[model samples]
Target: MARAHRYTVEVTWTGNTGTGTSGYRDFSRDHEVRGDGKPVLPGSSDPAFRGDPGRYNPEELLVAALSQCHLLWFLHLAATAGVVVTGYTDRPEGTMTENADGAGEFTEVVLRPAVTVADPGMVDAVPGLHERAHQMCFIARSVNFPVHHQPSTSAADSAV
Candidate 1:
């Protein structure tokens, strides 16, 4: 039997401006995402949809969720395999195509992770680990689009 997990969040729109969606361009897209015991995540639609550019958009959040899930799994696998990861950073990117009718979908997401290891022998294992990590990532598995990773690795060895 498969297991189940539950997750929840509260999204409250805060951009009434005294007039609530009175017109297409009248209301702001600003909102707050809150969960118990967590900091409220400020949110908005993409600026293209008349949202605040400074706030976090759902598109960006989806990409971030994918990247974060991959990172967490990668770290766990590296530690278990004794790869001794000393540092890690990811510059993930996603592409969303919008149709003329206004529907949109993310075509793909690329996870570009730069990983550093504590020893030279651990270097070889870093690149191959990304695939396994992606496979194990919950968010990556949940998404419809392909999630590809292009990872670069560095060893602490003074030779290079």
Candidate 2:
């Protein structure tokens, strides 16, 4: 088998909650990010010091990674099966609950995918496709949390 792909990122902290010193990390981007300020991304209206919003949070990123991975796999499978997937969108929600140590953790996550398939019967394969996607999803397999998919859809108007 061929070697798997790899990725790398570096983060740095500058302040502590004790002295009220604000901190920022370099995502290798031109700008910096702060945990206590508003998100730096354009249109990010967070009250925190111009931070980029919650999308940059670790837990949220994990959920998004899983959702994106599943979508990619589903699209690949659909293409191979001669199914035309026109549009795809999903709202993946991650729930944070208290763990045994009294710390909050993402105990559950739900992925609601709205897929447009060419054939109406293709909707029935959503469950199976999701299962297979989950099996191949690297992020889902790496976490201990329970991830569920609540899928709904409409028929694709035309094949592209």
For residues 73-155, what per-residue lDDT tens digits would candidate 2 score against the true structure? 98888788777777799999988775677566688889888889878877777667777888888788888999889877678
| Count of clashing pairs, candidate 2 | 12
Q: Report residue 88 deviation for candidate 2 (angstroms).
A: 0.7
TM-score of 1: 0.95
Question: Model 2 lDDT vs. the true structure?
Answer: 0.68
RMSD from true fold, candidate 2: 7.2
Q: Which candidate number has the best TM-score?
A: 1
Q: Give a tens-digit lDDT track for model 1, residues 14-58.
A: 999888989998899999999999999999999999999999999
Q: Each candidate: RMSD to true structure? A: 1.5, 7.2
How far does residue 17 in candidate 2 sit from its true spot (Å)? 11
Instruction: Report the C-alpha displacement of residue 25, candidate 1, in angstroms.
Output: 1.1
